[model samples]
Target: MTPTRKRRLVAISMILFAVGVATTLTVFALQQNMTYLYTPSEILAGKVPADARFRIGGMVKDKSIERGQSLTVAFVVTDGDGDMRVEYEGILPDLFREKQSVIATGSMQGDRFVATEVLAKHDENYIPRDVAEAMGKAHQKHNVPEDAAKPSTY
Candidate 1:
């Protein structure tokens, strides 16, 4: 093969290699930060990874909020059919209250979830899509009418 042709081929090969490496690194970084959302029912059913971090979405169970000393709080999150206890050591959002939708990011510690961040529904009329689907699934499992599971505003 000609020297110029060989040089062009090497250059093309190097460019392809660099592109492949960049693509692989991008995917790796995304995977490291990716957090899957799980429903309370899914968590109760042991469908989540035992050690990996994830987000749990559900409604804050009524009368389940318990305030501990300092900024610690514990509450039960429910997706209608199942419940998971969540412990968080941070200031909860003002909109956070009983029966409100929430998504907590953390990992399971034994039978409970230890949350690093807690997100409350922004308004009475809005619910996260993941939480809504979870609630729908729970309702379906229990044979509860879908309307009954929805908030009164919806």
Candidate 2:
């Protein structure tokens, strides 16, 4: 009702509006940059957006590593329930090998995953939580023994 009161109300309203806008923009930017990790089975089942970049985690299928021209390499990643073919044209990590856990960051190109970066499990004792859980679920679905379902068995 008073001029001073009106000015104070306007200032408060503008501050609130600016804060809301900043919060909304932060959320939008985070969503755009966020990458999800999926299992090979989930990807095979069409759980990922066709053109969205994401990470796939699984064990490198035994004997599936193939070297190609230049730095190109191809391999199959399996979570025991399903497999995905991955192609990468960069130098793979030193620990990258068959029968090891790997996380490939890329997008699907038709049936195959075209990876921009490939990460190998850092050591014998460490497996990514997502990969470990996916492997355990797959093994349990197949009625595997509890001991065999452990990520340490990798």
Candidate 3:
């Protein structure tokens, strides 16, 4: 109706539009870069996205490790109730071993987890906080073996 009122309305509208655009762009960027964590049980239940880059934390199943040419190694990451196979092409950590808690970062292919990086627990009786919590929950939910349920210092 009035010239001053019209100018003020236009200014407010432009400010709100800029704020909306900035918020949308920020959310899109974060979505693209986010890497989530998962457990073997979640993978088995088909809760994990197949194409998204994510991290898996669990114990290295006993007698489930295999060595291939060079530094390539394959192992089973288990969360008591379920097991997911992991393939890594780099040197494993010195602490890596069967029955140890580990976190692998990668994507899933078919039923196998193709890991780009693997991290094993550092100290005896000490599992990474997040890995320990997830494994403990999984162990509680299923009738997993006591040894498997316990996070060993692998």
Q: Pick the candidate with the highest TM-score.
A: 1
Question: Ranking under lDDT, best-scoring first?
Answer: 1, 2, 3
Each prediction's RMSD to truth = 5.4, 5.4, 6.7
- Prediction-by-prediction clash tally: 0, 0, 1
- Report lDDT per candidate: 0.93, 0.91, 0.91
Question: lDDT score, residue 122, model 2?
Answer: 82
Error of 1 at 73 (Å): 0.3
Which ranking of candidates, highest TM-score first?
Answer: 1, 2, 3
Candidate 3 per-residue C-alpha lDDT over 26-115 given as tens digits, one digit per residue, 9 for 90 to 100: 999999988887889988888886588999999999999999999999999988788999999998999999999999999998879999
lDDT of 2 by residue, 1-154 (tens): 9999999999999999999999999999999999898888888778898799999999999999999999999999999889999999999999999888999999999999999999999888888898898777766666768677687833
Output the worst ten-in-a-row residue range by lDDT, candidate 2: 137-146
lDDT at 87, model 1? 100
lDDT score, candidate 1: 0.93
Give the distance in Å from residue 42's predicted Cα in candidate 2 to where it truly belongs.
0.9
Query: Where's the lowest-lDDT run of ten residues in candidate 3?
Result: 137-146
lDDT of 1 by residue, 1-154 (tens): 9999999999999999999999999999999999999898888778897798999999999999999999999999998888899999999999999999999999999999999999999899999998898778766876867688888973
Clashing pairs in 3: 100-154
lDDT of 1 at 63: 97
lDDT of 2: 0.91
